[model samples]
Target chain A: MTEMAHALRVQNLSKSFNDNSVLRGISLDVATHEVVCLIGASGSGKSTLLRCINLLEPVNAGRIWLGDEEITRAGIDEDRVRQRIGIVFQAFNLFPHMTVLRNITLGPREALGLSRSEADERARGLLERFGLSEKSDDYPDRLSGGQQQRVAIVRALAMDPELILLDEVTSALDPELIAEVLNLIRELAGRGMTMVIATHEMSFARDIADRVCFLDEGVIAEAGPPDQIFTAPSHPRTQRFLQRIIAAGRM
Target chain B: MGDTKRSAGRGSRLLGNRAVLVSTTSTILFFIAVAVVVALAPGSDIVGERFLNWVHLKQSLLGTATAPSVAEAFLLNVRMFMIAEAIILVLALVIALVRGVPGPVFFPFRAVAVVYTDIFRGVPLILVLYMIGFGVPGLGLGYVSTRSDITYGIIALVLVYSAYVAEVYRAGIDSVHQSQTAAARSLGLSRWQSMRFVVLPQAVRRVIPPLLNDFIGLQKDTALVSVLGSIEAARAAQIYGAEQFNYSAYVVAALLFVLVTIPLARFTDHLIARDRRRREAGGAAPGALGTAAGAPHDVPGAIG
Candidate 1:
């Protein structure tokens, strides 16, 4: 993985919160513009892994590289590194006090030092494209589950990040609202935005992912093309998880 | 006819069920309390010339506060409270920020914040007033010694109350969802920037009720400054009482403080109600373990 220059190269990443270790010595890589899906049952460390990569959750052991710069090293500018990698959480952490426009423009205006007009203009463009032009003046509390999630995506996209991490972006949505968000994710992938998605939407993962990684416990149990992972998972744990999904009529 | 009577029963002013029963019982209890107090008033000599003789009480109360010799000492009390409240907000917020600051670089400042909160919160306000008001001036230091005892009084009150307000602010800051901080940090905001923009605003909003509750306490504690011989409302009342041998002057001071505090307490209650409504209406993101931003002030024991 180190020999070739991947867009994201995570080596032996480990994370723990006090007594419980969530992610243990996991290594992975994603080439530029590749859509990688992390598939796991609830506590299989998928979200933690993505969070660790985003530097939201610091790794107890390991290294992460975004493009050529090693990000996990001491004295590294974490904010600078994070500006290049956007992340969207399942709960869609939109600032309730601010209007949607301000929420989107905050990163650009404050972190990137863009002028207000410039940030607003860019944010409006994203909002227009996402079919949310009318909602720009609205507060986050006024938004539906789906609208909020899309705004969260647009917020990340406003940074023009090189890589984006999505951690179950649709899990908090209503069944109907889920489609809007999934379709937006589909649009981003169609535009060849490099993304690492941690999701439970099996069919969507199958449709969107170039490579599918099945995590069990705290390690990647299997990884391959989506077809291989979805149709014929090699590991017993992966097979069992898929079997449950299929039995639940989600696959 | 029976159905009509049943419908009227539901809306009846009198002849109702538990609502009428409760209201009637409460009214009876309230009047009984009034009667008991009134019956005991003369026995306690409170109805006599010393307590509530209308003419003597009226003159002393009005002379001491309402139309005082020094711009209405009541006004002085109001002014002192307003200044202290404003300064305490900023000062306490700074101390809370310092106390919550991360990393070892701010160790000394953080340590100072911790010790300040601990000691000031532990010491009685009257003693603290004595220390800063009298003790500091006794040191005979140049800048420390002021001709106006009010300055020393204010400093002392600020020292003691900022600790309490800082704890309230800290509790508010802590009650803010951890995910809010994480979300801000993930957006490339520095720790302080995240706090300034995202976390602090939410924390402040959530804690406004409790913070105002503290302010109400501060407003009354402004009276404690009277110990320094500042001619604020309480001291003025005490002097008037000493001269007239009627404690009705103290009643004026009490009434003045109550007049200011009642509205503030009501506003605090209003904020608390609005906050609860907002939460129930789903303003916060769905919490991680279902309690990040949902539970408010569940861990405020340290502050008290």
Candidate 2:
């Protein structure tokens, strides 16, 4: 593959919670406009790694580069770094008190300092794209799980970030609702939005992922194209995990 | 059909039970006995004289005006009580916001707040007023000028009510869901900004009804200012009734209090109903999601 320009690079990323080491010397790189999937069992440091990428959870020791921003250095302006990265949580953490329109507009208006009219116009366009135009006035509690998660994606997109990190976006939804949210992500991947998703929806990953990295015990056990990773994972742990998840029809 | 008829028949039999009749009759008798005892108790002649003397003392309070002494007394009492209660509420909210929640740096502040609340809540308002109005001056704090009686009464009220209001605010703050804070922070809002924009707005909404109830309590408790010889409404009524040997003045004062409290109580009830409706509407939308997923986790837990 052409050395597709690097959008993010992590070297020696490590984190420990008291006696428990959550991430151990994890190193990875993602190309610009690429969709990378990190798949792993529970407690394998997938979520922690995602959080560390945005400096939401400070890593114990590591270097992270978002383009050339050098995010892991001491006294890095976190707000500036965060402005470039958008994250969506499993909980669909939409501000409850705000209307769907306001929820999508808040970060852009506040962080990007967009004028109200501009923010509203951008937010309206995004909502329309997500098929949530009619639900703008309603609160998150008013929306279905699939609709709420889709709104969450739009909320992150409104920031116009260089990269988006989605942590277990479908894990919290019903089986039927999961497909709708995954479909939205798949659409985004097809449009080449430079995304990193930690998900158990293996079928979507197989279909949309440009590359897949299997994380085991705080490190990437294997990383390759979707075809090789799914059908011919070289690592024994990756093979076993794929077998268990496929058998269980979830991970 | 047989089971339904049998249950209905059993319900009728229970309704006619003698024990229920005896308990209802005894409750009525108890209230009647208390009323009779209160009515037969010594006439207010002795208390009437004392009340008259008190009224005379209050008449000179604002210094001999054409304002009916009774009206003047009532107004003065009300003014003093309102001033005191307002100060108490504002101070209590500030204290609660600063020191009520659990935090390392606020531990000492919280401890101090607890002690302050305990001391005032533990002692009677009358005792607090007496100390500030009379006791301190006796200790060469110098007879607090009669002009300052209203001020002293307000201080006393603040000291006492702040404790109660603080607890009310503490409960309101604690009621906010931790997830709201987490969500706000994850969105990159600083701690104070999260509190200002998110938590406090919701917390304040939840506490409004209780805060109004506390206000009504404070209004009624304005009677405690009487111990300090302030011309508050209740004291004014008592004094006027004593001098004239007519209970109408006291009744008028009670009516005035009801006038102030009733509207507020009604407004509070309306607010509570409106809030409930809003919550119900917010929750109703999630039921649609329920059908999509057998059980999607609802916004997990009570919002502040």
Candidate 3:
């Protein structure tokens, strides 16, 4: 991928919460249709960084450019930028009061100003793609964790975002349910949806990510092709982190 | 397995029967005691005169041949009370929503709401009406002083009930999961938008049954407006009965109250039953999971 074709770019991004900096001067880039996996220990700022990229958490400093639009600058149309990017949370935040179909259609209808029939048609098609056609009328609370997470992805995809942010999408699921969510994600990656995923699933990152980033102490420790990042990481901190995670089978 | 099932079924049936018997006997006993006290009380003539007057007035209000002059009295009273209660519900709902949004930004608003609720809830409803209808006018609030009694009654109900409704809203907002807020934000909804579209709807759903109960309370409380002598349903009946030395007027007023309150009570019961069904069908699994997750912490401190 060429530099000009990057889907998202972060430059000197920093964020603090109540005087404590959670992300400090982090910079990264994702090429169009590329899958980048962010792997790190707790409190390492991987999640914070993902949130900043999606503008779910505001950055204290620096710039985030999504294609030609400058999202990090104050007074930028944040909603417009957000419309181009979709985010899925670890908690599978499907609205409990809404049926699965409504969950997927709400953002599209409200943000994009799509008519109800059009939104419904799009939602139905997306749910069918996610193999959740039959569950469209059911509430999120009725779904298995894996199924809910998949519906969450479909909800995001229905927005037709240019880029998607996945924040530990499988972490809240049962061990048996994790694979199904991850497999759905892997399929999205295969279909060329530009994605930045914060995950602990080592095998997924190794298999699906075009580039893997190891974040530590609120900064990227190292980033490279999956093979190099996994088997031949140059940073000692990255190696130690990988060893600990692998030992815990949290990879 | 069949024997265990049979035993469990038998035990459940016995417990159910015992509960039914206990409730029925308690109710009957309570009525019997009330009747005995009323029958045996002193000042029988004065009490009987007052009682009979109330009854006669009520019967006249109910269109009985005993007193036709009081029929319009009952209708006017019922209309005024119903209007006042309706105003109270609407005002309360609005106040509750404004005070119920989560965050420090809403803290001062919530504090004010809490103070309002405490003051009104602590004060007698009659006192509140007197203050609003009489005291405010004395303070040169011309609009209030010049307004009709029905208008004053509605205003008083709105002011007092808004506070209670705010607390109900606060409770409902607090009941929604924190994760839902986070999820809405992640979806790019502004804080206000998220609360309006996502959290508030869910919170309102959870608060519906309680809201209905509050409405019922407000309905009964509307009778207090009669203290202001506005000729609301109860006061209208009271006036006719006192004049004619008949007791039916009070009975008529009581019946009117029953007519309004009984349907609301039954509706509340239906709401509660529906809520329970929803909980049993969808909530039980989540509840079990939650308890299971919490159970480990409880085991070490168990007495056994």
Candidate 4:
């Protein structure tokens, strides 16, 4: 990877909640439009690292540079930084009270100060592209889990964000619905949307990610290309982790 | 209930075998009618002459042009209720906002909010009315012009009811999943924007039934404002009844209050039932993830 051509850089980042340290000395760099997948067990701090990069959770120590901008520095506006970087959660937190169209348009109209017609037009286009145009008027409660998650991705995309951090977007879906959300991610990747996804879908990660970072006990135990990590991970911890995943038939 | 009904059909009589349910119910109704007829008859020891005399008559049924009666005073009650309710809705929301404002920078304001909620909520509505309505005027503060007692009474009601309402709103806000705010924040909404545009809309729906309960309470308590010297329905009834030596005017006011409150109360119940039915309908979801690792909504417990 060309480090100077990086779109995102996190150098020696650390975060903790009440001395229960989550992310410890994490460091990584992502090139423009590169998709990096963080694969780890529940307590390995994959989610925390993503949250820290988003400034959702303040870091205990470290630096994160978004392109040429140092977003972690004090006096920097967090919301402006967030507008450029969309983050989607596993719960598909599309505003339940809002219809599908409203959910997608809110961020653009409110945060970005886009015109109502402009936001709605773009949101509708995204809705149609995602096969959710028919359900645009329906509330979040009306959508299936897969549809909600897809709409969530569309909501993030509506911002026209440079990077998207997806935190286990399909973990809550039923086994059958998981494929629907994963397919959407696959589409995003194909379109060259840069993303750092913290996910449990190992095969999906292995197939889609340009580089896979395996986090173990709050640090990256292994980082490599997909084939290397999936087939012949050098780190014993990465090997053991993939072994457990294979035993469970999750990969 | 089904099992009990089947047993009852097998002659397991709850009332009596000879007294069939329909005849027993009608006989009970007949006895109640007999009692009403006796009391309503020309002269009865159980009911006073004033009640009997005022139960019917054009003057009691509709107030006279020259006198304070239910018809004339009903508007006062409505005026107070509408104004207090409108003010309370806004004031309570402000109070809740002050109470829940984030960060240590607003600690003093939060403390003031806590004290305000604690004092007004505990001081009793009557005392608040007495203090603001009567006591404020009694202070002889020359700069403070004594407005109409009705205004002072409304202010007091807003003060006290707003405290109760603030607490209710806070509970509703607390019940909202933190993830809702998180989702909004991740989308680049400001803290206030997330709260105002996301959390509050959802919170308002949750607190509507309780807020309406307070509103109905406020409606009835409009009578309490009468003590502050407003000749609303209750006070008008008191005045008319005192002169007429009949309490039917008070009954008229009570009936009117019941008429207003029953519909509002039933509407609140309807909203609550609808909300619950929607929730129980299944996990298609309403967007709140309950802050679970995965949105643990329709599952009802921690999702595996």
For candidate 1, the lDDT comes to 0.85
Please give the C-alpha DockQ score of model 3.
Answer: 0.20
Ranked candidates, highest TM-score first: 1, 4, 3, 2
Misplaced by over 4 Å in model 4 are A1-3, B1-44, B52-58, B64-67, B141-143, B283-304
- Reference-based lDDT, each prediction: 0.85, 0.78, 0.78, 0.86
CA lDDT for candidate 2: 0.78
Q: By the TM-score metric, which is better: model 3 or model 4? A: 4
Q: What is the TM-score of each candidate against the true structure?
A: 0.89, 0.76, 0.84, 0.88
Q: After superposition, how far is residue A105 of candidate 2 from its true place, in Å?
A: 2.3
The lowest-lDDT stretch of 10 consecutive residues in candidate 4 chain A is A1-10
With a 3 Å backbone cut-off (N, CA, C), the pairs that clash in candidate 2 are: B77-B231, B77-B232, B176-B304
Q: How well is each residue in A114-216 modelled by candidate 2, as lDDT tens digits?
A: 9999999999999898788988877677678888889988988888889999999988887878888888888888888999999888888888899999999
> Candidate 1's residue-wise lDDT over B1-304, tens digit each?
7876788655575556768789999999999999888778756665455666676556755684443432277787788778888899999999999999888998999999999999999999999888888888788888867547788777877888899999988998898888877777788888988999998887887788888888888888888888888788888777777777777777767877898899999988887776676576555432311333424332221121
**Residues A1-251, model 3: lDDT tens digits:** 43459899999999989888888889998999999999988899988998888887778898999997888887887777777899999988889777788888887877788999999999999888878898787667667778889999998898899999999998888888888888899899989999999998898899999999998888898999999999988999999988997888866
Decide which is better by DockQ, 2 or 4: 4
**Which should have the higher lDDT, number 2 or number 4?**
4
Candidate 1, residue B22: Cα displacement in angstroms equals: 7.4
Q: Report, to 2 decimal places, the DockQ of model 4.
A: 0.34
